[model samples]
Target: MDHLLPLSRVAKLVGTSRHALQEMIRSGTLDTFDGMVELNELLRAFPDTKWEDDAEFRRITEIKERAFGKRVFERALPDKEVLAARLFELGNEYAATKALLMHYSQVLSWLDEKIDEIEEDQNKETRHALHVLRAFIVRHLAEIPPDAAKVQALIAQERILKIMSAHVTIKPSGHEFIVESNDTLLEAALRAGVSLDYGCSNGNCGDCRARLISGEVRKVRAHDYVLSQAEKDSGVILLCSCAAVNDVVIEANVAGASDIHQQQLVVKVKAVEVFNPQVAALHLLAPRSQRLRYLAGQSVRLSAHGASGRYAIASCPCEERHIEIQVLRNADDAFSQLLFSGLNANENIELEGPYGEFVLEDASTRPIIFVAFGVGFAPVKSLIQHAMSLDLAESIDLHWLADEAGYYQNNLCRAWADALDNFTYITHASTTEVETTLANIVNDYPDLHRFDVYAAGTAAQLQLAKRVFLKHGLPAQQWRAGATDA
Candidate 1:
């Protein structure tokens, strides 16, 4: 029997990123069957992988844990009841395999006896051939394969992963992610940058209702929202209240830009991170009961102390209730002045209107080119991080044209390029010759039509960039622009 693993799981098993595996598949270096990798094929592809030593795998796990403000060995485990169910399922598989192996062993013994009887009735040459065949079978069966230890290690690691996490697939939309560390299906979806519809994440409202198309789920939390018997009979359950018992396929509605209704809430200021005299980032924390619902590259209106302004959100939605918006120092903007000089932590701020359609084309697997002019990097940063979480882009190249403030978060961008195999970072010095710079950028991509480009800047800058990119063979539809003042 051939054992197959999903691409995401295989990426974890081999201590590599999903983007790297996708690249290998596109280049014909690795083979996948129905979007999954066979066990033996995984061994063949990564010959140098030390299956017994998982230090690299452990290192990646540590990074992810830290990202969630947790430490190693402290990752949340599945609920006890869910754990028991998974263990029982594994035991069933082991028992079935053992029974099949015993049956095969009995068949081999019978064949050995039959061969001996045939040998006794045959002539000298035929008897010698039967004896050789029997000896060959015994020798091969007794000797262990060279990769037996590796295979054992691989299977052992995979079992632990399955127990600690469960894979989830969203039907119709085809979004896939792993439910890890005691997170509900809805929580996992949001963290993976899959925007499924929901209200009151603790499940008072039934907006997160989804149908289980396959596998099993266990309710881990109580919900005030009630489901009808008919809905229950059809496998409908609240995503916020349940956890996947094993791998599951769920049919849920994914909210698009227009699908997300405008939300207003009172949030508290977390911090003011001033990058320079001209720019700073405002970090806001929403209440546990009411988090703002917005996609990456969208803008929000913030008002505090009767001073208000609209700014592009600089944080990815995967960050949960934490919201980051970079503010540029401007004489005309009251919020910018307050943020730079007087915005205090724990101050109450009113947030409203996640307005803009400048989001990612998440379903597209095409290469992406992101262009940011000055503080327009806010939304671009959001889009890039969202893309990273989704792991759908074939490649991402970021071109940041600095203003007088310069690349304030230059190190952050470099860290992204360092961490991701499919990411590239390029910086252009501030210049008066805008058209020349735009022309040079376009000239670098001869196959521009094969790429999707997202640019954010002032209206004039966007228009100039768009005209130049379109002239260089970029499809008009492939270009997405966000209007930014700073």
Candidate 2:
């Protein structure tokens, strides 16, 4: 080796300890292929000595725009005094412009509210814009101040209008149902009175995806961050995301959601103990005065100032008042940092919802097959716990899959593993044994059919499991898969 300094040397040069350097490498902040700093990336990550160990802090400030750039215009509607007369007298051009502006105003108001909740130093400027936008929305119509910055933006909007005004035809659904305003198809086909599927008005969960059979749409606010480019390209747009560019034809299958009450809860962390090196069991207790009830498989979004993330409730619905969530520490993940960096314990955090519709149906004893992968074991753990408590039929089978023995709390998982007589733990550790355990088990057991399967995990793992289940003659309709693109 010509001159390779050890990690210790680099740490000393950067005025930090060896342990900090190791943490950085483990979390990918400092890259080292063979004990040598990929000097360029390392320097870029820690441009100053102050950020040597505080890598996340530096990274967050440097990358705020990409993460929190989704701000909406919250300004009030335009003055009716000047434009109302002109707008009323106008034909197609007036109607289109007015509708577009109204959409912008609504989106901006919503965007500002969301931005207000985010606390980051780098987001101050964006937050300021949100404040201004909020004021405009409350006023209903305020002049967009003429500024050098808005000239180009206004030009772009005019171009968009030109593109959108192109004439197109909308195919009628030919039904009698309420036309959901958010659904561009149903909105366009209003004369036909066809319905659209919608669950929560919140776009955080995706349920309103539909095919744009033809024609185009100019989004109201680009609030459809839940959509992937692939989904967009495949003609799938959330009724929540589309505003008709031109009249368009669409296939409509609307699913109605039951009324759900939303609540704000304050949960105190009761325990944060390591289940395994990578997995942790977190117990949170709601305020004694607050009575919050959630279904077995629903998830809650947890928020601490400057941070927010969704975690599936891991405890049974019939369990004690306290809620339990299992968290896997991904060293590079921001939420994981809070968990491991002594920020998760004994802290009071805000929680929203008991969201998602993945719970088991009642009155019908549909055989359930639970397939959990990695940290996805959390929700299955809850559903199983609920089923056991309710004394539901032993007709349920849970298949818990992981890559290694030490991936999660073996003892906690084992506790459930041992107590539930109906449940079978399928431990797959490809890291150790040479055999293809997963494929082999499916191959050997031909009796896997006749049960409904619910699979949750990373997209690839879940997809693989689905393929395997289908290959073994499992009915596609009986299987439910949950995968988050994030």
Candidate 3:
């Protein structure tokens, strides 16, 4: 079911060479060489095999056939060998993404089957432990380092598998094939000698959105985010939430246009001003000797003691001396409590950033609508300020929304409006004044078709707005979102 088993593994198990595995696929004996046996075929060939009634295996096989147009026979799962062969055969051939996802679902289902089998084994403690460890190792092979000595040590002490053979094939992209243990997709691309474009590794930043051109991946953690069902249907994936389930080929350019390097600055908290009862505005001064460079609307990572969190830089890129961030107390958040109450003004907080791709585009002559929810206003504030500083003559609508008006600071928008000539600020108190969604407001607008919208906030609100935009026939590329969890 899991498509990414090491080829070396299948080679050892079936006594077939990796080349022969590929040859098998080429010669039509196997659909893939990914170290998977067709479920039905395996059952028929070996009636005494243990997996005949395995639900996971059956589920995987069914899903694979239904989703990817691939027939699963004898064990019904293709390991890495089969996957690689298929990728090679389908090189750049267009296939339905939905079909591919179905295949992935099937693979995961099969893995679940294997896990169940191992868990059900009534064996010695050591054997059971080994089984569990092997399952983990097989499922997470991409995360293991290729070091021989370290792997040997793990095999000896942890009862891990000694080796899995894989054909180390690299495409003509001349992309360095770098594998990582516990590395972000962006980090892996970099190590693999690819210039993968990424805004933030934190899921909160949506800079690394792309499609999984091929292969399977596992979804893991995410920040509070939002995306349209249509986007998901279209194969758009967030690299932040994706981990390799197999050798994957994603439709993302490493050297994309958005790649940027910002100068790092270790700054000290010079002052903390409570902008409102709920929101605290933090100002940092470049440590007596260092300065950080970042564009407006970029974000940063902050660490206090040992815990760290991500926040958007509210200051303009030109401001080298002072950096500012507006944070609202999340009474439910441990990090927020520490920042607002426990941290001192002079305390040294670790900072890293000026990373984010939510900036205004160059050819964006269309009117702009900015929608912000809660503290999601941080990046929006920066973009607005930067637009004014650059003196870009553009018509922009700032639609700021919150559950309660009093909980939000109105002065920030008021100041920006007073300073700028073309900016229009509209506030919605979702609690009492306007409980309607932003998409409703966009729909009510006179010239919705003339504006390019950027939305950031709750997943529900963004989804509503996305549907409205798409319903009105806005181009998918024109409506950009910040981050999406769901």
Question: Of the candidates numbered 1 and 2, which has the greater lDDT value?
Answer: 1
Off by over 4 Å in 1: 23-29, 60-76, 113-126
Clashes of each: 0, 15, 28
Give the alpha carbon lDDT tens digit for every residue of 133-205 in model 1.
9889999999999999989999998899899889988999988898887788988898788999887788788
Report every candidate's CA lDDT.
0.89, 0.55, 0.55
**Prediction 3 TM-score vs. true:** 0.44
Q: Per-residue lDDT for 1-486 in model 2, tens only? A: 122334533543454434456667778787776655644444555564342244553343234212211111122232232133223334466588789889987897677667666635437677677677667676655555444233343334323322323222323432222111233332323212122454432344465567777755555434534778898788887764555543345665533113345668888988887776677777788764453456666778888766777778787533434787777777556665677666556799788877776665432345567777778877777666545433333356666667442446455555455544445666665443222445665674576666667777767777777788888878887767665223
Which structure among the candidates has the greatest lDDT?
A: 1
Q: TM-scores across all candidates? A: 0.92, 0.44, 0.44
Query: How would you encode candidate 3's per-residue C-alpha lDDT over 1-486 as one tens digit per residue?
Result: 422334433333333334454455557655533444443332233334232233444454354334211111223233444345435544433255467878987887787677667667556885678677767856775465544443343223211121111122223332323222334454345322244455545565566677766665555455445666887788777765665544565677544225566555567888887766677778887763345545556677777777666777766543435778877677665556777785677778778865667666633446677877766687777666545432322567888777532436576577556544457888776653233555567666666666778777656767767887767767677786654211
Show pairs that collide, candidate 1.
none
Lowest lDDT 10-residue stretch of candidate 3:
158-167
Position 229, candidate 2: lDDT = 83
Question: Which regions of candidate 3 fall more than 4 Å away from where they truly are?
Answer: 1-257, 262-265, 404-407, 432-435, 484-486
Best by TM-score: 1
CA lDDT of 205 in candidate 2?
Answer: 46
